[model samples]
Target: MHTSKLIKDTPTDRIFLFVLYIFIGLAVLIVLYPLIYIISASVSSPLAVNSGKMWLWPVGFNLDGYKVILQYGDIWRGYMMTIFYTISGTMVSLFITIPCAYAISRRDFAGKKWFTNFMLITMFLSGGLIPTYLLVRNLGMLNTVWAIIIPNAVSVYNIIVTKSFFQSTIPWEMQEAAKVDGASDFQIFFRIVLPLSAPIIAVMALFYGVGQWNDYFNSLVYLQNKNLYPLQMVLRQILVLQDMQQGSATGSTISQSAAQAAFSKEQLVAVIKYGVMIVSSLPVIMVYPLLQRYFVKGVLIGSLKG
Candidate 1:
C-alpha cells in the first residue's frame, strides 16, 4: 500500500489526487473551525466574545459562564433525567432489536420475508403526529418516561443493519453444529450468536444512546411536566427563551444602571451561550470514542454484503 511500492501514477492521476487532497483539507477546516470557535468563545470573557476578540483562542479567559450554568437547579435535574432515559432506552432498544434481527436473519424462520416487509412498510409510513399522539395519550404514556422510550423502542433501520451483520458474519455451519449438540434455537442464539455480535451491539448501543440523549421533541410533545425534561430541552430553554429574556432585561437596565453592570451582563450572556453549546454536546463527544473501533466495522460489514 505504500506509495513507493506501488506503480508510478500518470501525470493526470497525480493531478487528480492533488486536487482531491486539497478539497478534503478544505472540508476538514470547514467542519473543525466551528468546533474550535465554540470552545474558544465558551472560555473567553463575555466582553471579549461580544467585542469579537476571540477567534482561535480564548481571550481574558474566565469560568463565569460555567459557574452560572452549574448554579441552575433545573440543569442538574435535566442531567439526571437524560442519563436515566439514555441508559433505559438503550437497554430496551438493544434487547428488542438484536433478538428480532437475529430471528429474521435465520433462513429457517417462518414468514421472515413477510415480517421484514411489514417492518419496512412501517418505516416508510406511520400514522401522522396526531394519531400517534392520541395513541400515546390513550395508552396513558403521556407525561411518563415510557412516552419517550416505548414509542421509539425499535428502529427499522437498526434492525436491517443488525440482520445484515448477522447474515454476513454468522454462517449456517455454526448453527448446524450447535443443533448437532442438541441445542435449541434460543440456546444457540443466546450462547453462540450473541457472543459473536459484540461489534454490532456496540454500534447499536451508540446509535440508540445518542438518539435518546439528544431527543427533546418527544419530551416536548408528551411531557408537560418540566421535571421530566431532558438535558437537551433544558438547554434549549436556557439558550433560546431564557437568553432572550435575559438580554432584553439587561438592555432595559443598561439605560438606568451603572455602565459596569450593563457591560458585565452583555458579556455574561455571550459566554453562557457558548458554554451551553459545549455542555449540551460534551457527553456524545466523550462517549463516541469508546465505541468508535466497532462503529466502522459494524456499519461496513452490515451494509456491504446486504
Candidate 2:
C-alpha cells in the first residue's frame, strides 16, 4: 500500500489568503458594477434611465435607443470612416515600426546605440501639442485622412517591444549562415525572420489596430468636414447635442410644447449614451479574443528576455 500526505495551510496562511480573496472580490465588484449598470441602462426605457430606476438590471424594457442609432445615417458613414482609418493606419504603423526596430536590433547596424538612445529619450519627452499641430499643418495633412494616420504612425514603445523580440528571440547564427549561403540581407529577413515573427506581428497589429479604432482626438482637432469624422466623433456630437439640450431645458424658460419636446429628446439622449458605449466598445472586445493567444506569448517573450 502506498501512503499519501496532504499539504495544508496553517492558520496564518489561511487568514492571509482569506483577506486577499476579500480584496480581490471588492476590486472585481468595483470594476464590474459600472459595466453592468451601463448595459442595464442602455436597454431600459429612457424615462427609467433618466430617473435612476434602472440599477443592476434593466427596467421598463425598450429598444428605442438601438433603433435610433441604427437609423442615423451619419452613424453608418462614421462607421465606414473608422474602419478605413483603423486598417490604413495599422498598416502604416507596422510598416514603419518593424524595419526600424529590426535595424536597431542588429549589432552590426551602425550607430544603433545612438538611435536607440534617441528613441528612448523621445519616449520621455516630446514637442508638445502646439508644435505638433503646427508640424501637421505645415505638412498639409489637416482635414485629410493623412492627419488621422500619419502624425502618430510609429510608437516608440512598440519599436522597443519589437526590437526586444528580434534581439532576444532570433539567433544571430541563423543570419550568419544565410549570409554564408549567398542569401542577401533582405532575402533572409523576408524569407526567414518574418515567418518566425508571427506572434509579435499579431501583437503589434492588435495594439495598433485597437488604438486607431478608438482614436477620436485627431479627428476632432484636424477634421472640419462632417464626412471625414470617425465613429467616435459622430457619437461625441450626439452626446454634446444632448448636453446642450439639457442646459436649455433646465436653465432657460420655454413654452409647454417646447418643454415637453426637450424632455423627450433628453431622455432619448440619456439612453443613447449608454447604448453608444456598448456599441463603441464591442468591436475592441470582440477583436481581443482573436489575438489573445499571441498577445500574452509575444508580450512575455519580448518583455521578459534580456
Candidate 3:
C-alpha cells in the first residue's frame, strides 16, 4: 500500500527531474557551441565565416585551410616532435613518480615522513623560472628534449595523489606474502602491486601525458632552435605571423582584391587553429574512455585510506 503511494510521489519528483535535465542539456549546448562554431568555420569559405553566416553547420564548405596547413613541412615535424615528447616524458615521469610514491606509501620506511614533507614543500615553493633556467643551462639541457622532460619528471601533487592511492588500496599483507615467496622488492612491486594498482597508474599516466603534450611554456623557454620547436611553439609563430601580415598598415601594400584574398587567408588560419586543437587533443581524449572504468575506483580506493 505504501509502495503505491511512493510510486505516485515519484511522478511529481520525475517532473522536477525532467526540468533539471532540460537545464543541463542547455548548459551542454552552451559549452559545445564554440567547438561547433570552430568546426563549421574551418570547413566554411572565408566569406561565409567572416560574415557570421555560419551557425551550427558549415556554410559553403571548403578544404583550403587544411591544404595550406599541411603544405608547411615544419608542422609535420612539430607533430612528430610533440608525439615523441609526450610518450617519452610520460614514461619517464611515471617511472620516477611511481617508485617515489610506492616508497612513501610504506609506513615502515625510515624518514618517509620527512621525504613526504619535503615533496609537499616543493608543491608550495619553487626556485622560480630564472633560477630553473640557469640550472638547466648549467646542466647543458637547453635546446635538448631533456630540458622539457627531465625538469618536470616528478610532479609533487601527482606524487602525493599516487602515494595516497597506494597506501589506501594496496594491502601490506600482500607485500609480506610476496616476500615470503622469495620475491624481491622489485619483483613484488612489478608482479603484485603494479597489476592491482592499474587504475591509479593509468590516471597518473594520463595526467603526465596530457601535461607534456600541452606544454608550450617549457619549449618556449628552453628551445632556441626552430628545428627543436614543438607543435605549440610552431602554432604560436604561425598565428603571430598571420596577425602581423593582416594588420591595417601592411594591408595598404596590397590592392583591394589582394586585401580580400589576405582576409580569406586569415580566416582559414583561424579555422586551422581549431583543427589543430582537435587533432592534438583527439588521441588523449579517445584514450580516457578505454580507461574510464578504472578511474573512479582507483581514485576512491587510493584517496580514502591513505
| lDDT winner | 1
| Residue-wise C-alpha lDDT for candidate 1, range 122-187, written one tens digit per residue | 988999999999999999999999999999889999999999989988998999999999999889
TM-score of each: 0.89, 0.91, 0.85
- Best to worst by TM-score, what's the order? 2, 1, 3
How many residue pairs clash (N, CA or C atoms closer than 3 angstroms) in each of the candidate models, in the order given? 0, 0, 1
Tens digits of per-residue lDDT, candidate 3, 1-306, equal 455433364787899999999999999999999878877777777767777887779998776666556656667788889889999999999999999999999867899999889878988899999999999999999999999899999888788888888877789988988889899998988998899888888888877887888888999899988788788877676656643366542223222323445554456656666656665566777887887776666566545645
Two-way lDDT contest, 1 vs 2, winner = 1
Q: Which ten residues in a row have the lowest lDDT in candidate 2?
A: 249-258
What does candidate 1 score on TM?
A: 0.89
Q: Pick the candidate with the highest TM-score.
A: 2
Task: For residues 218-237, write the lDDT of model 2, one tens digit per residue.
Answer: 99889999899999998887
lDDT, each prediction? 0.85, 0.83, 0.78
Please give the lDDT score for candidate 2: 0.83
Error of 3 at 248 (Å): 19
Let me know the TM-score candidate 3 reaches against the reference structure. 0.85
Residue 82's lDDT within candidate 2 is: 95
- Looking at model 3, which ten-residue stretch has the lowest summed lDDT? 249-258
